[model samples]
Target: MSESALQSVIHTGDGRTLTRSEFLSLINTYNWFLKDQAQLHLTYSQQDRDGEVTVEGFLNISWGVTMPIRLQIQDDKQTPPSPLITPEISIPVSPLESKRGMTRWGEYSDLHQIDENAETPDIIISNVPPAPIPYETTTLRPMRHKNTEQEAESNLVRCQSDASLVKMRRKAKTAAQREEERQHRFSINGHFYNYKTSIFTPTHGASTKVRITSRMSTHQVIEQLLHKFKIENDPEEFALYCVHQSGEKRKLCNRDQPLWERILQGPSEDIMKVFLMDREEEEVSNDVAQYLNLELPILEQVLLKLREEESKEIQRVISKYHHQHRLLSNVLNCKVSPHIETSV
Candidate 1:
């Protein structure tokens, strides 16, 4: 074995470099000493951080029992396009045999054997039958016993019964406790759905109206809004609608006229504008007014109030995303802008 260095030519792209055939020759020389016929698998990993490259070795799987093996190569000098070099190999041995075969270099002892004629150990047998003893007999002592020096003690029937009842109650309570903690993933229309909190800045003609769903803290709502804005460029289509306190009809409209115009220039926006504009034009202005309140302050007030209930809702939704879906939590963490594709 070579001394562990901050680097080896294998990673540093230095030292006596071997061609693919020469490197395999070195591996073959060392591998010839291996006595076991097990089909050993090897894994290799290489990393380059802060300048130098590092190579790591680990067990891929047991010999003979095959598995999908993975390898990572990091050196620019040795990879294809350049003359490829075979990597150096080191055989591993168990700690127990390491000392015996110790050499100035290192030890490579025969550990696991895959002999075809290896004898199997015989199984041991026992004659005893298992017994199920009562809880009182095994754990609790009887109050009375048939002994010469003592008369039979009074019955502990009540005490034993009370203990049994207590145990039963505890068991029942524990079961109920688990049931209480069991989380029910909320669902609607027979499908599991997460609570999506969004801020809508709708545009009605020249007016901009803001509406928020899922009242949460202002910071949390703004953060979520920022995230939405990054992913959804056209905020107007999300539609700001007013559901009046008096149970009036809901009205929806764009809140950012300039943004709405930009959106309408796009093909999808043209379709939406053509459809929704004609539809809204046919309705009475008051009917539109009742549902789509273009009042700016009211919309702003609604956004301001959203945070009052938003903290709990964000917590609930984020927890679900963390434990259930594992979607937004990472995005939330690192404060990764939503526009970045994490997988890429």
Candidate 2:
């Protein structure tokens, strides 16, 4: 908060009021005189201006513009306050004289130079004075302690830190638990198709595609599996063979539908056994071809390549066979299948 600045107003010598423009002109003149550092200036007396309120108080103030000083306007209706003191009109003074503490009066104490720094004297405290011994023995003072409120607050901080550590441990444990749960769902034979075809809800609208799955829907697939396994028999004989192999009772064998379904679902030991058996058969066939000193056909080579998982080269050969029809397809009779097929 600062002192309020009041505008210096003058009364016209006439009894009538002057217009606002006239009032502005007089104030401008007053401001210019102050800037010029004039020694004498006109006093804001009552008789100076017409219809203006008598000059009462004279204020020398400092303030910011945005936070302007609020003052009451004195119209012709009311008289203003009396002047307490006149302004000390600015006067020219030499720079040397000003430095030597010269004011309008005379030499004064050089108070302005108090802030100027001077070299400090060195200080040394060699030894501290001993604590005064009490004439009378006093009860041992309870060991000096921190304020109870402050001590309790520090304890609160420790408790909070402990809680934060516990929370972090719990969070880490929860993350580990989630990871374990995720890994548990994983199968060694797991691949993208299983995830894509699994029973999961879509994030959006009604699903267009539906998978109609059955445990043992078609006899053809069973026949194919048996053919791949070299079991040349009807479904009944196959079931019997499977029962004997599994060591299950005849009645228990009826669950072959589910057994086939689970086998097809993969990650199954039975499927792995079939694959391994096929590999062994292929190896035996290769050995027989070598012993006979007979070269394997191009299609057989392609099938072998495919079974060994050289899919990209197999596709390249297939495309080449299609382009050069007589050299490949006609000569070898290569049967085409869609992507993901292991056999020709």
Candidate 3:
């Protein structure tokens, strides 16, 4: 038969007709499926009957089950031939044959007995003589003498004294450095201010020039200013604003923030103007007040334009009402007047 005809034969188990390539492909797929479970070698051949095919193989399955498989495919014109796969009678496997190199249960003890029975040769040993001591090497004193003990004690005392001297020098140096740094002062706007001392001048307008440290918060600075100036305003009524060179002001929203953070938030200039404002009175800094004063003329111009637009809108509405009343009166006069007919 042709190669195509042979492949067209139906395969059983899965119920599908397959070409020669498909049949081989199916066998390859099963090869992978049974790879772990069995060892199979498949061979195909044409049977004596016409239109009959046979596939024979040997399968050695798991758990020592070995059998011969014979698959028969008979062609039936009415329907596709169904392949019949039959396995030969399985032969009983002998246990001894299967466990050729495997050790039995009692083999370990047998090995132990063989090892014990093997004899070891006898060994001879002679006695060793004692070594004689030289007369010149002998010493009258013991290994640890009084002089050596005294030397060790003196060395320990010297080490302890050196350690104490080093510790005292380190402490003195640290204290001197701390005192020098504490005495250092920073200059703001040509005025030198020391953090350790309160340098402030009180004024009547609830204004003051106070020295603020990195550790002081806005609230603490305000409190210090209030206490020094003797301003009786409530603590909550006061706020801090950083004035810019452009005359714009930014309110310090977080009063609990440290003065250092507030300074960082200001412009990059070394010295910046900061204002303490009374929220109730809305008292802004002099710079901010001047900036608002400059904007007064522009604000007045905007108000004037808005009023002119309002007057024009009112006049347009009044004119529209008068025109509508005139049209209605003309229509009433035409209907009420009588028409007089002259001679034709």
My TM-score estimates for the predictions, one after another, are 0.15, 0.14, 0.24
What C-alpha lDDT values do all the predictions have?
0.32, 0.34, 0.47
Give lDDT: candidate 2, residue 126. 70
Model 2: per-residue lDDT, tens digit, 1-344? 12221344332332323444455455455545455544322233234344334321111111111111111221223333332432364347654343344244222122232222322223355789988964543366544544999886767644443334444445344433455454332111231113234332222211111112222333433343434222323443322112111322122133333222322223223322111011111122332333343345865775686677877778889988778976765556545644575776
- The C-alpha local distance difference test score for the whole of candidate 1 amounts to 0.32
lDDT of 1 at 67: 20
Candidate that beats the other on lDDT, 1 or 3, i.e. the better one: 3
Candidate 1 lDDT, tens digit per residue, 1-344? 33434223432121223233443343444234332532321112334554322222111110110121111221222322322333344446545443344222122121111232333333345897878963446356655445653332343333243334444455334333354334222211122222232222223322211223211222332233324223233223232222223323232332222221211122122122211121122223444444354578886776677786798799988887678555556557658665655673
Question: What lDDT does candidate 2 reach at residue 318?
Answer: 96
Candidate 3 structure, TM-score to reference: 0.24
Give the CA lDDT, 0 to 100, for residue 36 in model 2: 54
User: lDDT tens string, model 3, 209-294?
Assistant: 45444334567767665553334456566666665555555555543443433323332322345666554434357654554655
